[model samples]
Target: MRGRSRGSGSFPPAINTKAWFIAAILAIGFSDSRSAMSIWKSAHGGVFSMAIRANGEFFQPPVQPICAQPTMWLAALSHPIVCLVRKLELLVALLVFVMAACFFIEMSIVKPPSKEVIRGLFVPSLSGPGATGDTIALLGALVMPHNLFLHSALVLSRNTPSSVKGIKDACRFFLFESGIALFVALTINICIVSVSGIICKNSAVVYGVALLACGTSSTITGTYAGQYVMQGFLDINVKQWLRNLMTRSIAIVPSLVVAIIGGSSGAGRLIIMASMILSFELPFALIPLLKFSSSSNKMGENKNSIYIIGFSWILGFIVIGINIYFLSSKLVGWILHNSLPIYANVLICIIVVPLMLLYISAVIYLTFRKDTVKFASRGELQMILSFELPFALIPLLKFSSSSNKMGENKNSIYIIGFSWILGFIVIGINIYFLSSKLVGWILHNSLPIYANVLICIIVVPLMLLYISAVIYLTFRKDTVKFASRGELQMILSFELPFALIPLLKFSSSSNKMGENKNSIYIIGFSWILGFIVIGINIYFLSSKLVGWILHNSLPIYANVLICIIVVPLMLLYISAVIYLTFRKDTVKFASRGELQMILSFELPFALIPLLKFSSSSNKMGENKNSIYIIGFSWILGFIVIGINIYFLSSKLVGWILHNSLPIYANVLICIIVVPLMLLYISAVIYLTFRKDTVKFASRGELQVPETDKSKVANDSDNVEHKDQLV
Candidate 1:
């Protein structure tokens, strides 16, 4: 009894089985696949607003003038304002669903006749040509594949007995509970469908409320399901609100873009298209699940019986058959009827033919693939989850780059660029996650924040130092680090010119992607993203430098000296960049590595002065360093010194011993370079020990032209849309 109580055996057969989760991950956990499948759920937010507007119009009194912004409408109903847009919609959606659920529960019990209920439950009819397609959407909506992961996760919450009889009993009770849940869901769905079918135009509020509830609930639940999938498959537990925000933001952009372009009709089309995609994506999830369920080696005593397996496979085959039939018919009809250029149609055929074959082959392979993992111990799982230094980065770089392995399916240029950007995002997220964990550990030890900061002062940069080395090596020719989506700005500004500018001279060829070359729309979007990044970075960089010069307390002579150095240097680089960007012919940003080395030398030039000024009370006034920050500043100073010493020592020793340049020549090289190196070290040391010598301006002594002040304020925010570039 104690043993049974101790083991919450509900999930032991599923969650505890490594074979199950691993197989599931392979089926649906790839970044692109999961995101694609999630779009249908995301389309609802736009439709929710549409529904609100429609309902708002229906309830409007003849006396009240119409508002252009439907979202901002104040409906005549004073109490429950029909369409509460903005922040209140989510709460409104919740209320709508609750009220609808109660109404439906009572209706299902009292209104619907038993005969009609049973017939509707038991029988499905192909009433028309569109009926078959609607059925597919129905199946997709009802049998959401991601829910399998969510269910397994949820079952872990229950404390079920571990004993054989107890396990069986627990399964039966869970099954009954699930049935009850399904019945309630079905009742709600049935009533909603019926109401829509009836088309009660007089009661637009009813339908609008229904839509609001649906779009809000679908997105909310989908985001949660994604959260669980990430937790279960990848063991990634992102904060819930953050995860929701990310998902909704992703949804909003495409939806809003479509709405703006094509209006209500376009949004409706998008929703339908998303639904179709969701329907087709089901087999990818279902086949693998079916494969796992039928295997006694994986599921043990819980494996599906022969009868159940036979029935399930037949159902699976039917769904796949319907998909294939409809897809082939649609493609064939489009191919025959479309009035595009012959070459374009041929291009479409070339792309579509192989994809169709690949899809068919994949379904067959997933069905037949053997399940090798029956169990995994804790250490094995841990090792698999947290990859070591080179293992994670190296293999990805190699495999993606290897022509022999990927062949024609080689990574797209944009994909390669995006991967490099995402690598930095992953690094930033991991740093934050680990730092938070470190803080918790310090808190337990009683001296939390200061000690944590002190430890970060040592540990974080060391981690960055080595992690950066791997990143530097892994992404040599094309490295972009993203902060927001636009941080791919760096990629476009630098690496993009390398990727795209050279192509202007060459005849456009499809050899690389072959029929999968960028469409005109994609090419246009890429150009836009590229230009926005370039223009914004250029604008911001110049503004920042100007601000630094104008705002600083550096001596007038020093400021003049900086302008002398910066003006020509900026022109030289900017001219070179423009030449590279617009030139018809190009080389592969020749000696990119040497360029990196040259830029590395410039790092201390920026950091030393910035640190020296930021740490000084006179320089920054109230913004000057606190003790915690002062300690961090010293640590940075030490690190910089250590780096400089090692760099100089390594070069000096190599030049003296390794390079057998004639002895006199070697001596001459060292004599010439060593003094400049010493000067650099002397400057660093001087900055490290320097006291604040500059005086702060008196309260009213500052002088600025009124017009110039407004210009600065306006210029600062002129490119606010490009905040992501920062």
Candidate 2:
């Protein structure tokens, strides 16, 4: 046989090395020659051109081949790599199965789960004290933030047909694939939990070994997830190694710290904490996914069916509700049981409670707030992921429901009705969760008579406030519409006396309101109306107070004490009203700016007393003013007070500079005013930081009758009485 000869003086070993590397990479990525050829051609500018011929001879044309493959040995070596690459998912799945089998074998050799384990896996029960937390952890682990993104992306990666029937078939196949995978995972998890329960001592090592394998394998998946998320949201490409390195680096620091400080137990606790975090983050991922899948705009003809959308939302809300319950229970327990001093507790409550309220508000906003940025680009998906995860779902729901957007794909009436029912269920769950916690706290705490009295007083008012809030949320037309124009005018008419007296007094006094004030006729009418209103208010206050005092049975000395105190206060109040009504204006017609400046200074005087009373636990009980009401009230109060102080200081400084006051006089004024200001500030701070002292009676506690000792008995009757009281 004639042997083909190489034209070159020597075959470059570098060429062989390069060829081998190229062949190996191709083999790792593609199993079939068709795929390999396509990729190779793309890389080599149109053809899989090689420097050497099939017979180990150089081409006669002297044209430089895109790639140099000098021999067949390198190409043949890549075949096994190709096969491995093609079966990568299958290989991983097999490895997992093997590890699971090994764990099962270990369990059989040692201690194994009882038959009851199977029942436990299927039937949910929170038997023990830690069961709730354990259930939450399981939920968190089952529905992880990374896993949510991973699963969706994995499903989308399948090569499916564009036609309706083909698409349906593809979906069915994928669903089957997902169901099988999840079943396997669930089985493995159940086995692990059971095994751990059986052999609590040595199971740590065994579980750890298995977990290490699982985690190590998941690193590749995690890397891919990160890559997909980054590309989807940011439209950026990163090298696999670099992406893996970044994620590993971030995770390693925390792991190292926990390992160093807490060791293995701490590491385990860290896992629990991570699960909780994932639970909290679940809503952010879930809402968007449900929204997008249901939305006809995003999914087109292949949008999620009505039943699927309804089921998904209901499930999502259930998860969210559980997370919220877990959070609130833990927080309240911590607050109640903390070893901090009462004052410190009060301070923290004042700060942290408002923050918690804000957090809740933010969650609500995320749920309902419309998306401003339309996710039109791949990079914008990241924006949705970051800021508007919950809101991203809103558009989906909107589009899916709207005939204009979805056309034939719009949700049907049955689907809509079911969705609304699910929505109602979510709302009901939230209310029940909150109310149940409140009721439990009330029933659990054994309190003194005084505290019980306070609780009773507070509870009624709080219930009213709660009802008001619900009514406002349900029926209020617009957020900014506090009152209708007619309602406002009627309110002003009712409150006219309180405003009119001051206005008329200032206008006529000439020292406050401008010189060109109200005309005599207007002044006369204003004074008459103001004085009449004042008389009615004074009469009402006196009658109510006196009647209350007289009707109650009291000692002669006590009655005397009440009258002595009340008579003087009534006189002073009457005298003040008279003086305000008669006072004359000092200045000419004051401009609108001057009026505003005056009102700004006066606002704090009204607000401070109002807030002091409203936020007072003595007056409002444990269900005191809501955090928003209290915060907004205090903020407005402070701003007004600050303005008044600034104006007062500026005027005092100006008077001292221009009026030729002695140094001593100025110092004396400062001494008096500064102390008063300091006292005012101190009073506000004290009020703000004061803790509610009212406590409610516990489940079995009953108030004892003062008169009849024979009738009072601590028995089932007492329990019945307690129930009646609640």
Candidate 3:
């Protein structure tokens, strides 16, 4: 027999993915060593005076520049920017922290040969008010979108044999690589947190002292990572080389200038600015990935399991819900502080009334509406977008949970289940917070009769909407259709690239995503979001838009009625803008100018999908949605559409009525009759037109395509033996 060739037969072992991971971890340690050494050298003297040891370590004691007493003039001049930059650095740091947590949780499931370690990592204290919340938040943040892409691409770097032994070896190597990366990530996070916790704990540390040492440096690291990720994804190799130098220069030059001029204040300002940037930019990368991963067509059999989907949703809702809570709380607190009288508060109740209606409408849409909005554009978008400060971690839940994207190496069932439970607990906490707030608001302002009526009006519709939605989802089938992992991944791949385009064109046009890296939809959505933000900013700056219109709109308080009508619309617009712009991938937005354009584009196509999928006479066979289900879904969907149309039409009608009959603007008859009329007609039309599109086949047996051999067992022998046994 020919001697076994090393290439085909395999030597004991050659190069492995684990080595790369190990190398990366080592690289991190080396970088940390350099950082520490630099700090030490500055303590002894300047960097120029430092010398290296024979063992490749710095001999000088690293020290921060702040230790050297600066001139009063320089300190005064530099403190502002330093404060800003340090704050920005913290935001980036927090974002990265969240990403690391999510990644580790996801990785732990498919990780190799580290069962004891994995168990230790996941063990969380279950006893505190925030223990469950923090864990869920940590997990949500860690399952980052780019990290998912990074892992998928990382695995592709090595070629393995197409045999079982080869696969086993490959898995082992991949795990090691992943483990090393995770460790390094954890180290960086711990260092930052340790530094923050230590400094924050010390009252003597003060603002400038705590920031001077680590502020710009931390931001520099994050900027480097962001730039690296963006450039790497776009395949722009040369840009990375240039960006590495440019980014470091940008960070260091600013710090050096600030040190020379305003000292700590200047550096502080830069850090603060950086923090705000990161906080605001987060939602753009989060929402798209959620929509994508939860999508059945994208994940196929590997799509988010029902439990995971339900859990992640609750978590997302809670996060969004908190923001809403804060908004309401702050508003109420402000009203109380101003000492507004009881009558004014009743006027406030009038505004609150319509908002309750809109809120109910939104809840109904989310719960009962077929998950047909392949891309969310309104309240859901706002909900996801509001979570920008949390960073790309939200999408990680969607990506990591999908087995199709990760192949056989998806998160374990236990992990998915736990993640979901954690998500719900967080939502429950937020609900409690919001409910208590509403109760406080009612008690503080309105009479008992008014309060009870307010509660009934708001609570009844909201409960109905939420129950309807839950009931709908509970009954829907959970099957996804897809072919290959590559195809599945591609469906959601637009998220990363779309995230980059906005940061480029709108953020800094010079830093375009580079090449054919973005789609038309991405560009459109980014601009739309940008404009909406600008609009909101403008409104805030103008007294008439925010303060006057909101606080003093009606005469006896006609402003109150106006606020009730406008606030929800404003919120809806804001939410739509947010969803469109912040998605991981780019989506289309109809400009105020293009409102007609988008409606025309979206309406027909949207209805087409609903019509085809819901129709019983169509192609689904016995797998069709039942007649009852289809009828209910159609009624619900059409009603939702009708509401959208009615909101538009009624608002337009109200505008005409107000302008034409200015004296009658405060008339309750006008408000009640106009809105009620639109609602009645829309409801009637929706009910009449309802029909079931998806239905079971008369033949009874639904056709299914061939799937994984693991999924369905072959029973040819049993089929043949039945006759023999008979």
Candidate 4:
């Protein structure tokens, strides 16, 4: 009985044996084929030859070695392994198709399970760590940002049920369908991990070569598929083609370089970097979600349950808190080390000080920013574009839970409650994992060995406790009350509309968020709150950049370093502010020429957000922002642009000023307060001319849209008649 409970008898012999056989065959084949394939491929033309030939290209040039001779054997071995992976990938593709079909079946034929089964699914259990983690990730991934938009639109794919019972049933079916698809995906992931861990453990050379080939091939395949799919769906042509080529090149170059330089070390660094990046990226999604989901004004009576709103807030905070810690620790460490020259340090402080004040002011605005008693049309449009569109939840959660839209089926109460809890728990785990690394990095640098060890001992248990909480939430079985259509839509209405604003406002070309979005203000507040948390990181990055510059043996190199490190950063902030101030409403595309230019410049930047939002796959749905957000997000886009430009310009400017050809320095006002002067004038204009668009009210008060549509309906008819007469 004890052994059975321990899962000794839980394994079905049929599946167990099949799994082992598969693993064994994969392992055997991997070792045998590697050496032969590497030798053959290298002697011929290496992997590229095979790729080009596969594409029906005539191979011409004497095949050149793609890898060093030493690495050639390893590369050749990767070929058959590549074939195996491709075959397995095809199988996975087939599985995805099957899953899609099952989803359709659930939607069209099978009835949703009873509430009892729903309860069984939601309540946490020891079930197995593998199962538990898979379930959590499956659910997490299912809530994709794009799907929010897609699901909302897709629910309109067919006539929806209006009856409450019918709607409830449909919701149940949608949830069931999604659940099954997620489960299958989880199974595939587990299988891959299990297989790979067993097969590739000892052969570092084989592992590296195979992984690189697999990753590159998969990327290329995906790109080809994506381009082909887009071409089929849209009428984009050669000019856009060039744009795509450029964008792909820019994105791929850095990644490729990183891979080459870091090798396997790069992969680990990339993972850590990605985690921090994700943490930073979360707020961009979370704040908008929390604001939109919780708003009574946007959603009306269908607003999120207090419990949901509260839980989401806590989860968002935890994630944000962790990210802030990582950021701050790095910063503080830099400060303590004083890696930069005294002059350079002063320059940075001078630049950062005002911006810090501005950031604080912006936070005050966010905390106190009142929604207008009436909705402004332009603002509404902007808010929707900026906030609602980016997060992907507005449409997804609405349609998924809507009884009127779905009918006699919605996520059972257990599913709804458990899903939210599960999402939070997953987020919490990520936070814990990241926070531990950040803390460990800081202590290792600063603390005595014994003290650091003691700290780890204390911190480790707290982390475990956090993990336990997540586990508890996962296994807690309870029945869930399905939300009504109104409730679901309310969540959508509020979230989708409001979510757009922060992204839009912050990114806006115009400083419409006023002083709210300035880098200084934002950075300052983040720095202050995040000091103890991210001090180490800030310190580390700054120190590295500075130390590299100062310690160079060559005077020319040191000068170049200062130029690279110091000047560009300052210019980036200045440029960000300038870009924001000068931003225009390029919303309306008057011509195809106009559209192409906009897409070319904008699409690359837009890819960043899209990659982030969609990477998780399940976090968003169709509601994910369209390429249109790129046009609108030009304002916030300045942050990245400013950083790049400033980094470049500062050094160049300093160099030019310092090493002048005598003529330019005399001609230009090197010490003039031109930017400050311009800023003062602009501030005056903003203060004098800025419209008070926002109006705060008591909670539950409704805002009216700018124009009553019914009133304009007759006027539109009259205009049409007049046009006909003319």
Clashes of each: 0, 16, 72, 109
lDDT: worst 10-residue window of model 3: 1-10
Q: Name the candidate, 1 or 2, with the larger lDDT value.
A: 1
lDDT of 2 by residue, 1-726 (tens): 000001011113443233223222221211111112212222222222332122222122222222222111223322334433335466558657864874676477456546677678678787977677777766666555555555666655455667887777777776787788778778777766776544333333443345433543344444555555555443457765565455544544444444446533554566666555656666655665666566665466788899998898888878878877877787788879999888987887798778767656645654665533332667657543433222333344455666655668899988877865654465455456556766787777888768867876887587557546644443444323236567777556545666777666667654454567677898889777776777777777788888988788898799899889988987887777666655554546667888898777556556766776777666666757888998998887777777777777788778877877788998898898878767766665665566657655643355555555445554567876543322
lDDT for each residue of candidate 4 in 1-726, tens digit (9 for 90 to 100): 011111112224452343223222221222112222222232233334343122222123333223223222323322333444346345435535543443333223323344533465466443643343343323323332222222232333334466655555555565575577557655434333333223222322332333334233322322222232222223223232343344344434443344455543453344334323333433432444355445666545545688978897777666555445544554555666887888887787677656655544533443344543333467668644442221343245445665655676776777767766655654555665558676868556866888778877887797677556645544544345568777787555433323433344454333244334447665456435433333343454467766876786778866786778776874564455445434665554245665665564444345444444543223444554566664565445445445544544575567766774686563465455446445544553444344445444533345444475665787899996544322
Question: What lDDT would candidate 4 get against the real structure?
Answer: 0.43
In the range 97-205, model 3's lDDT, one tens digit per residue, is 4444433432333243455444545663456443433333333223332233334433433555656556566666766756765675665443333232222211221
Q: Scored by CA lDDT, what does every candidate get?
A: 0.57, 0.56, 0.44, 0.43
Worst 10 residues of 2 by lDDT: 1-10
What's the candidate order when arranged by decreasing TM-score?
1, 2, 4, 3
TM-score of each: 0.40, 0.39, 0.25, 0.28
Error of 3 at 552 (Å): 97
Best by lDDT: 1
Give the true-structure RMSD of model 3.
36.5
Better-scoring candidate (lDDT), 1 or 4: 1
Residue 677, model 2: lDDT of 69
